[model samples]
Target: MRVRRAAKGVGDFVVESIGEAVAEVVLGVLACALLAGLALIAYLSWSFSPLLTVAGTGLLSLFLAHGAWGTFRDPVEGRRRRGWTAVAAVCFTLVAATAAFLLLYASDCGCL
Candidate 1:
């Protein structure tokens, strides 16, 4: 009886772990799909209107940077602060680069 109970418990644990792994994989796939879709939309918008796309992306980057700054300022137990700081820096760079590109290449597009 003891042997049977132990075997059942082990089996249950293995099944539970498998379920959690599957759930994580599914969620990861969904996230990738969502990101891909967003990238496609951004690309289409950029092709349609470079200025508008750059403006929208710049605004988004600013918001992301602000949020990252706020998170970084708060005390965190782990390495999250470093990650947030990197995000903030990347966002700032993105905004600056986009603006520079717009200014340098503005004459190429007669739409402006």
Candidate 2:
């Protein structure tokens, strides 16, 4: 009886862990999709306006950087998920660089 109970508990734990991992993966994918959609919409709406494009990209970069900072600062999450921290950092960096480039281009082109 004791052996069977232990086996069941272990199985349950494994299932729960897998479920949590799957949920996290799905949520991450959805978040990325949402961000991509927002970028596409911004591009379509602000294509002709350099300042507006810079504003949109800057806002997105700020949002990503904030998220990355939070992830890096969280004690439990920061320790448990180094990969996520790296991913967040990379995303923030890319978005920020894009925003900077857009701003520079706008200024240089006399569009600002």
Candidate 3:
């Protein structure tokens, strides 16, 4: 049996879905840019040190996380917060993972 809602428009549902998708795409792009900027900055310094890079990237990641949290709580898109939430989670994970890998690599090889 198929039941139709009495007052829902299919167009509205489609638009809302599209908006969610767009939000996710935007968040992903922003995250990538932030990560790439961090890496590029680290590479260009030529300090021959990972510590500086790690610290800089960590700071940038923290800033992004704060922005993400603000967006997540905004009233404009309460239902679509999931998209930005995923972005924030991924960004945090990537930053942590990169830091852990660098630390492990440095400790194992005595880079300091």
Residue by residue across 11-84, what tens digits does model 2's lDDT show?
99999999999986665555555556756887787878888888877876776876579555657743554565
Candidate number achieving the greatest lDDT relative to the actual structure: 1
TM per candidate comes to 0.54, 0.44, 0.38
Give model 3's TM-score versus the native structure: 0.38
Candidate 1 has its poorest 10 consecutive residues by lDDT at 103-112
How displaced is residue 37 in candidate 2, in Å? 0.5
Error of 2 at 54 (Å): 10
Tens digits of per-residue lDDT for model 1, 1-112: 9999999999999999999999866655554554556568989998999999999978876777775565547666664545656677667666566556445544244332
- lDDT of candidate model 3 versus the reference: 0.62
The count of backbone overlaps in candidate 2 is 0
* N/CA/C clash count, model 3: 0
RMSD of 2: 14.9
For all candidates in order, the CA lDDT equals: 0.68, 0.68, 0.62
Clashing pairs in 2: none
